[model samples]
Target: MNYRQEVEALQPQLIEDIKALCAINSVYDANTVAENRPFGKGCRKALDAMLALGRADGFVTHDVDGYAGDIEIGDGEEGICILGHLDVVPVQAENWQSPPFVPEIREGKLYGRGTSDDKGPLLAAYHAAKLFYRKHPDCRKKIRVIFGCNEERGSSCVRYYFEKMPACRMGFTPDAEFPVIYGEKGTCSIVVRGNYRGGKLLALHGGTVANVVPQQCSAELLGEPAEYEESLNKFLTAHPEIRAELKGQQTHTCLVMYGQAAHASTPHLGVNAVAAMAAYLEKVCPGPISALIHRKLTDYTGAQLGIQAEGQLGALTMNLGIAKYDGCKLELTLDLRIPHEVEADALAEAVRMQVAEYGAVLEYQAGRALILDRESKLIQVLDAAYREIEPEGGEPQAIGGGTYAKAATNCAAFGPAFPEEDTHIHDSNEYISLTSLEKATAIYYRAIEMLMAD
Candidate 1:
């Protein structure tokens, strides 16, 4: 029952795979991906690389069209799927204490883009699965360590994988917060587009991805430079979270504001540069963009805009993540994580109402809330494993972050990030403590054992 010894034993080797995956910087992209790239090329290679490692480690592995791949350990009628992702978020390296792509360890913490997000934890699970393969190769069930190339973008990898393979009898994904997770907020991505009748703003750009709170925003202006410079400075000053810089004279002015970036599900935990820019624009322009944001963009939770929709998980969260304006054409993308009970159209209506002032147009919509059976055998098994680790009764909760579990039934997100530790995933200087990664691997090993053993 004591798995800590096993987890600790794998520490040295698990660090190697975590470092390998982190060094790759397989950020989501089409160029880095090939024709089979449902998500992108870097991800595809990352997927293949992990599967190759699995095969090298003496597991039966398969790569499914560069979308997703699986490594099978043991033989059986039913399987336990340890799901995780090989892809990572695009890192903003300028502020990092260490070069992002180059993995570094300091004070027992591994630092890199994917260190805590998934790669580090995924490797832990990978190593854990290997232990089971060696210990009980003839077990009644199998352990398929599943990883995807596109968990960050569209999860077509998992979707495609499930279509090609079989669902797990029960499983866990180490891709989110932990002790345990009982529910996950619903998730939605919407693109709201509109045309402004040639405003003073030339081009405005902000945000790295729809799932992240924009840490920076930049805008070009066609106004009397003196008129707004003072106001802009005041705006930036009032919001210390946002760093604003001005370039060019008033005629063709450009302003850049830097904020802190974190996952959109917890926007209040981080600052959104787009919000600061919108605040200033609301003062200067009072047009659609400003009004739309004013009405919609609340700090973090979806309290404002009357979108305080809540369900079994928690309050719905909406992030006005990306924004841009090219010569009068304004485009914005929003990320929302709702409960399973919320319908896609209900979310759309809420968004449509918020942006009605902008005369916002819908460009695209994707993802509905996905829910797994909380009382199912998979959850019970995973919960028992988590309980075995933490006997003091810290309940298994839910979250807004999406994970590989969504791709299949009877799967839940498990983890390396303990409830007490914060490794700064998706932010600058992303790191995972050596202690945490080791602990996660052991937990994964035990969880796999209970489900895969006859």
Candidate 2:
């Protein structure tokens, strides 16, 4: 069918669809939540836009009460699903060069909030399905492209959809890197809350979401501004990866630190502002909160808490994603990606024991990890399609980022982000290369065709 040629012919329409979806700020908003719009108005709008596009292309579309939607092609009792999300993380507008919601193309890259993460890749997969259906009208298997609205905060959208609907026999989500993703690490989020007494730390705040490494943290302390500024400068001189600023009066001062932001799944790629701030505060406060921060939470490996594990898939990583300290109480939101070999309950217990010494309690939620056999039909088919295009591509690999694949059965994360390219999924100025998007469309088209062939 010459899938690459068909994709090239439809590239313009595919890019326009991606831009239309990316224009909506789909971050979940409880304030704007309504009956069908469980996530928010923006997410609902994104879902509707995708469905409308499907209908325009003469495909059967279904909206699952705004939590999720799907476009179906062909006819069959069982179908193959292409799962993707429309929701994106909150953005710091000041950090971006261009408006985050407004899609822009510069140096052959599309820049926007969800461009690299899922929106662009989702549209690419959707268009690939459309092209396949156009070329093969008598295909045996059906193709269902599922658009989810709550993948950023949690996969509540798909959870609701699956409760009302049944899972597909097999599928792939265009949310991760190329080649293929045969294994994904287990994911867990832990919140530690406690009260502390007798410390110079009065109030501290950082981070916007649990999946992103915080870029900035600000703390109010009971100290002279000049003294704090001197101490901060000394600290920066020793550890120059972060930047610090001091403000306010002599008696009470606010200290702000800036660090690099990356996905929580790969905390080593980022310099966490919360961790850096806590390190500095430990020297000044000498309290339980500071001690916990400096001792257990600062390291990305969770070595001090004795929860580190290296399995066949990968090592267990940790990110102190969010931290806030009010006058008397402190709360920390931690994101951990664990390998399948480790037990989530045991890891939580280890962390809980460490935090108990500081009079803190831990709340943990664990997510399932996807581990598929390398010789399975789904992985073999997707991997064959990928290698067909790039003969030198590596074998299917594992990842730490959680996707809708974990929410659905017999599904895995495939393509959109290539091996050598960094799409900046959860960071400022996220973008996707035009060439890569087109190539991914071709790969998805081939995969869908191969799966549906009689």
Q: Best by TM-score, which number?
A: 2
What tens-digit string does per-residue lDDT give for candidate 1 at 45-140? 677789889878777888888888888877766577788888888877886999998999999899998989888888888788777766765666
Q: What's the TM-score of each model vs. the native?
A: 0.93, 0.97
Residue 426 miss distance in model 1 (angstroms): 1.9
Q: Please identify model 1 stretches exceeding 4 Å from their true place.
A: 1-3, 137-140, 223-229, 363-366
Query: Least lDDT summed over 10 consecutive residues: which range in candidate 1?
Result: 363-372
- Per-residue error for 244 in candidate 1, Å, reads 1.6
Number of the top candidate by lDDT? Answer: 2
lDDT by residue (1-454, candidate 2, tens digit) is 3667778999998888889999999998889999999998999899889999889878799999999999987787556899999999988887898999999999999999999888999999988887887888777678888989999888999999999887878999999998899999999899999988666888989999999999999999897888776677889998999988888886899888999889999999999999898889877667788789889898889898989899978999999989988888889999999999899999999999999998999999998888999999899999999999988999899999899988898898998888888888789999999999989999998888877763
Candidate 2 segments exceeding 4 Å error: none
lDDT of 1 at 323: 90
